[model samples]
Target: MKKLNISVIALAISLVFSTGVMAQGMSKKDYKADKEKIATEYKSAKAGCASLSGNANDICVAEAKGKEKVANAELEASYKPTRKTHYQARVAKAEADYTVANERCDDLAGNAKDVCVKEAKAAKTTAKADAKAQMKTSDANATANEKSTAARSEAKTEAADARKDAATDKLNAGYAVAKEKCDTLAGTAKDNCLNQAKRDFGK
Candidate 1:
């Protein structure tokens, strides 16, 4: 009787441990499935955006494609068990910065518009700096050579800055259009319209 009781207790403990392990395995599987689903949705959105016409449509498509890339990267980052948390945190920060920069650009006019555009560019620059810093830290932690890491960081920063400048130019053009439209407005309406344009253009 004593032997039988001991055997039963051992079996129960084994079953409990096995169940916990299986649950953990299932959780990981579920995470992968969710990531794949998100990537699929992003791909579909990218394809749909590509079908539109005109400069506005082209910009819209490009933005959608960029977003898709980000989504896919995030999904890939998730599967990297060792660095998943860190990469995700970095992505979140970068996204937040981009959003704030875009909103800032949306609010400005004339010289103020140019200044706002510059501010937005600066915001993007900061985000790129943070990303490069993070990359350098990662490379350092992985025992990469200092020269190689520095070179890569510099290249990345330069590219990001160039892109920011291009975006600033586009914002300046948009502000010009808004200014032209403001000429037709009158008195308080004109002032208000211009103010709103400045706010939108990041003046």
Candidate 2:
């Protein structure tokens, strides 16, 4: 049953990733419930391992724990749907695979075991690096978008100020033309024309 449980867990995990969007709309409560279910299953799976002994039993226990952890991480990622959480889920799977691979490596001897361990570590390293890179890229894009939004707002404010300044300059130029026309008159007539220009242009 332990072996079968492992198979089912692996299949479910595969399906979760393959389907890609199944976790998106899931509520936090549902995700939490699923988490409890996985934990209970992990305990049951571990209990089944008591029937075995030696490295066989160790491998079984490791697989159970790893699957439980990975499943929880994946579920959490779905619930929160953040870049960091998604990265964590991917990292969890990589670590789980590494643990299982290392346990399996115990079955080998000498150079074979050495090779298996190296391969397992390499796989974990590569997967972790990829996860980190993706998270960094996502973060960078988010930051750039924020900066771009700010820049656009700033540009809009600057443009508005420019238009206001241009309008003031245009009003002043019109007032200057009106004052010149008033200069052509004399006495009370010229004084009245200049007053009107000042009122109209707010000079």
Candidate 3:
């Protein structure tokens, strides 16, 4: 599922980059029709979840809603084809996955469920961090292109900083997940787990 989501994101980003100013090719009428189509699909998808119950129903509903949001975000990115819109699309995907994952984690109990939720959150944080870094890099590069050689150097530095920050955020999120998992243990075992996590994540 993660691989599939990554593929979808890759495809969306590719499409977004390939069609610079895609709105120029799409008529307002066409965009409106596409939007309506997306809405109709979402409604149908949500209705399909009615047959399910309990956690199954919850998961189904969350998946339906997530898909709808991701579709809308992707559509908006395609229509506008800007870095910000692309970033928003990526965020929508991350949030959608996080929502579905959290719903799925409902099947677990106690510390296991906590760990699942934390892992899901960590995944979302990582995705968002990467998306933010990409957007910042793109913005900086664009600015550099419009300015002097010094601006190019500055953009490079900014890009590196963005990546470094993203890495830090991802590491911290992973550490949180690891720490939550340690709650399943006790005494020295839990302590050892936490210490290992700290060491692994360079706390």
Q: Judged by lDDT, which candidate is best? A: 3
Off by over 4 Å in 3: 1-24
What lDDT score goes with residue 52 in model 1?
67
For all the candidates, what are their Cα RMSDs to the real structure? 19.5, 29.7, 4.8
* lDDT by residue for model 1 (1-203), tens: 01111122112111111122222223667556655665666567667766666544554554554454454454445444334444554554455444433443433445554444444444444454455555545554444334687776666665556556656655665576576567667999999989998999899
lDDT tens digits by residue: candidate 2, 1-203: 12222222222233132232245768767766776777787898899999989889988898788878877787777877899989998898878877877777787665456545655655566566667766765665556557887765665555555455545655655565567557567999989999998999997
What are the clashing pairs of model 3?
none
What are the models' TM-scores?
Answer: 0.36, 0.61, 0.88
Candidate 3, position 176, lDDT: 93
Question: Candidate 1, residue 166: CA error in Å?
Answer: 21
Candidate 1 segments whose C-alpha is farther than 4 A from its true place: 1-32, 39-67, 81-100, 103-107, 144-203
lDDT of each: 0.50, 0.67, 0.79
As for TM-score, the candidate ahead, 1 or 2, is 2
User: What 10-residue stretch in candidate 3 is worst by lDDT?
Assistant: 9-18
What count of clashes does model 3 give? Answer: 0
Superposed by TM-score, candidate 3 places the C-alpha of residue 153 at a distance from the truth, in angstroms, of 0.5
- In order of listing, the candidates' clash counts read 15, 0, 0
